[model samples]
Every structure is written in C-alpha cells, then in structure tokens.
Target: MFGWLRRKFGKTDRFARLDATQFPRFAPGTVWLVGAGPGAPGLISLLGYYGLGEADTIVYDALVGPDLLAMANPRAEMIYAGKRGGKPSPKQADITLTLIEHARAGKKVLRLKGGDPMMFGRGGEEALALARESIGFRIVPGITAGVGGLAYAGIPVTHRDTNHAVIFLTGHDEKGGVPQAVDWPAVSTAAPVIVMYMAIKHLGSIAEKLVAAGRSPEDRLAVVSNATLPSQSVVETTLADASTLAARTDIPTPAIVVVGPVSRYRQTLDWYTGGENALG
Candidate 1:
C-alpha cells in the first residue's frame, strides 16, 4: 500500500523513508484528525502523511500548507473549513457535520488541521461531536506552532538558565475578546515563560494586562509570524512596546507570541537567519 507513496514522496529530506504500512490505515467510514504542523509541510508526522495519501475527503483549515495538501490523493475531494479570527468562516458545527456526513458516506475523511489538532485547534470539540455520533476516529498529532514555530524563529520555549516553567494559553475566548478566566497576575508573575496562540489580534490589551499585573514593561518578547515557513518573520521587542512595534511591522497572522528571557536566545540561535552559533 505504501509502495506508491514511497515511490513518490520517499526521497524528501525531512521525512525518513519508511514503509507506509507502519502507519494506521485510514479505514472507510472513519475520520482522522491530523495536525499539519505550523506552516512547514515537512513538519507533518509520518502517520499524518499516510492519512493524506489515503483519505478520500480532506477537510482542512486556513493554516494547513499547500505543499501538505498536495500530498493527498488527486482523486480525493478537498473541502475548505478554515476559521480565522474576526473573519467570515464556516461555523464549527457545520464543519463537524461535514466530517460526519463525509464519513457516513463511506469515505475516508481526514480533518487536517494546522498545528497539533488537540492544541487550541478545536480538535476536542470535533472529536466529541464524532463520539456523540458514534463515528470511529483516530488522532495523528502534529508539531504545534506554539513550540515548533518558536523554534523556527530561533526562540526556545524553555532554557535551563532562563526558565523552569512555561505556560501556553490562547489570547481570546469564544467571543473574540481577551480571555476573562485567566489570572493575569498569576500568569504574569508565576510563569517564567508564556507562549500565547492566536493572541496577535488582542495583543495590545493583553500586553496592558500583563504590565498591570507586574510584568516589567521592558520584558523581552518576540512575535513570530508565519512560523516555520519560508516567509516567516520575527519581531523582537519589549512588553511595553510590543503593540506599537507589531503595528508598524507587516508580520502576518497565524503568529505566536512568546514572552520571557528565552526570547533573547534568538540572537545566537537563529539558524534560519543567522548562521549556526555556539549556543546549539
């Protein structure tokens, strides 16, 4: 079954050549929730790659890279179910229903999401929906942008000399506003490093909250845009100036915001922009 895939995509540098049978089969009438990783197609897992090759229908998000999508069987049907903040996107209910409908039709449905499906990608909700409907499903984890994207930007989420703990949180709640449940003061003080996903839209407000919570105005912060992709860009700034600096830059969304001293390590670890340094 993997002979064709090995013949076609096995020579890629990022993925080691291996038998496709090692991965889970994309059974008929079942949905596979896969993470495409940040934006780099090569970051997709071996299982995810196999699912792409076998899926009969692919329901993908806005952040899934084109190269990854191109790996799907040409005869497969592609459906766009992207959800962007403040933009017109398919309703979550509708997307879940689409997955169920396609699976019920005896098609091998692949719900390809950007980043780790379970990590802020709404994979839980979708999985729950499939469970309620008694649909068989499998999860193929992908590198989430929060960590992988930051790595691509040369920012380590953790460094022994800098931090021992990290916190990951989304910037907005369901209503497209700053999350109200988070204890801003505790987050500001306790977490040595904070990695925020989908926080660019409300960055200014979030920054303000952090500042009011006792985080220093000059705390190092880095905003990595289009992370892990060739078009990626990193903006280094401080907590107080993050909103102003980001506003003046052309960095695009689907970005990750990292806070802490670990961001400073980018100066020596920026492999994409800077040559290899002694740090790594």
Candidate 2:
C-alpha cells in the first residue's frame, strides 16, 4: 500500500522514501489523533505523514498548516473543527461525535490537530470520548508550539546557566477568563520560566498578577507569532510593559508568550535572524 502511494504521487524525496510499513497502519474503522506540529508542515512526524496519505476523513484544527493538509489524500474528506479564541467555533462534543460517526462507518479517520494534540490542544478529551465508545484509536505526537514556537523566536524554555524549572499554562480557562485554579502567586515564584498559550487576550491581567506575585517587573519576555512559518514575527519586551507593548504591536494570535531569563538568550541564539538579535 505504501509503495503504491509513493508511485502514485511520483515523488522520491526523504518523506516519500519512508517505509510506511514500519509505522502502525491507519486501519479502517479507527481514528488517529495526529499532531501537525507548530507551524511548519515539515515538522510533522513520519507516522503523521503516513496517516495523511491513508485517512478517508480528516478532521483538522485551526492551527494545522495548509502544507500539512495539502499532503492528505486528494480524495479524502476534509472537515474543519478549528476552535479559536473570541471566535465562533464548533462545540467539542460535536467534534467528538463527528470522529465517532466517521469511524463507525469503517472509514479511516484522522483527527489532525496543530501542535501536540495532548498539549493544550484537547487531545485527551477527544481520546477519552473515543475510549467511552469503544473506538480504536492511535496517538501521533507532534512538536508543541510552547517548545518549537519558542525556538523559532530564539528563546529556550530551559538553559544550563538559567533555571531548570519551567511551566506551561493556558491564558484562559473554559470560560475564556483567567484560570482561577492556578495559584498565580505561587507559580510566579515557583517556576523559573513560564510559557503561556492563548494568553494574549488576558495578557494585561496576567502580567499584573505575575507582578503582584513577586515576579520582577524587569523580567525579559517574548511573544512569538506565526512560529516556524514564513510570516513569523517576534516581539521582545519586559514584563513591566508586556501588555502595553503587545497592544501597540501587530503581533497576531496563534502566538506564544514566553516569560523568563531564557528570553534574553534569544539575542545570542536567534538563528532565524541571521546573526542579528530578534529583540525589539
């Protein structure tokens, strides 16, 4: 089956040369939850690439890149299940039902999410739904934006010289407000580095909370937008002025906000900037 796909596409690059047999089959009547990686289609794993070629139905999220979608079988059914903040989106339950519906029909279903499906992407919720219905599914991990996106901005989540601990959290809860469960004061002090997803909306309040919780106002931070893609842009600022700077700047969503000393390292390691510092 794999050989036939390669021949049909008439491509012999490294991706096409991969032995699909080495990976789990995207069998019929099963759903595969695959991550498309940050913003780079090339970052997708070989198993994820194989699933794209075999799936009869692909249910993808907002952040999944067009390049990855284009790799799907030309004849495959495409379903949009993207959920963006402050935008009208599909209900999570409905998406789960859609996956179940396709799988029950004996179709090879692909649930392709942007970034790691389990990392703030709601893969666990969908996976639980599949389990409750006795549906067979597989997980294909991808590079999460918290790490990959930061790397694109030349920010490391951790460094030997810097602190060892890091924390990843969402900017909002299910209600689209600051998460009350998180002890902001404790987190501000405990975690040496913090990476926030979907936090742009509440950045002002979050920064205030962090500041009141003992974090230094002068702490370095960066906001990386369109990470790993051609239109990628990064904004560097201090925690004291993160909210003000972000509002004034056009750095768009699907962005990652990184706060820590590691942000300063971007000046030295920003490979994307051609030896120039990415700090703004």
Q: Best TM-score goes to which candidate? A: 2
Lowest-scoring 10 consecutive residues by lDDT in candidate 2?
Answer: 12-21
* Whole-model lDDT, model 1: 0.88
Give the per-residue lDDT digits (tens) of candidate 2, residues 1-280. 4664566668666444466357776789999999999988889988898899899999999998787788888889999998988799999999999999999999999999999999988999999999999999999999999999888878888998998899999999999999999999999999889999988888888999999999999998888988988888888888999779757646688899989999887768787754376443
Which clashing pairs does model 2 show?
Answer: none
Error of 2 at 234 (Å): 0.6
lDDT against the true structure, per candidate, is 0.88, 0.88
Candidate 1 local lDDT, residue 20: 30
TM-score of each: 0.93, 0.94
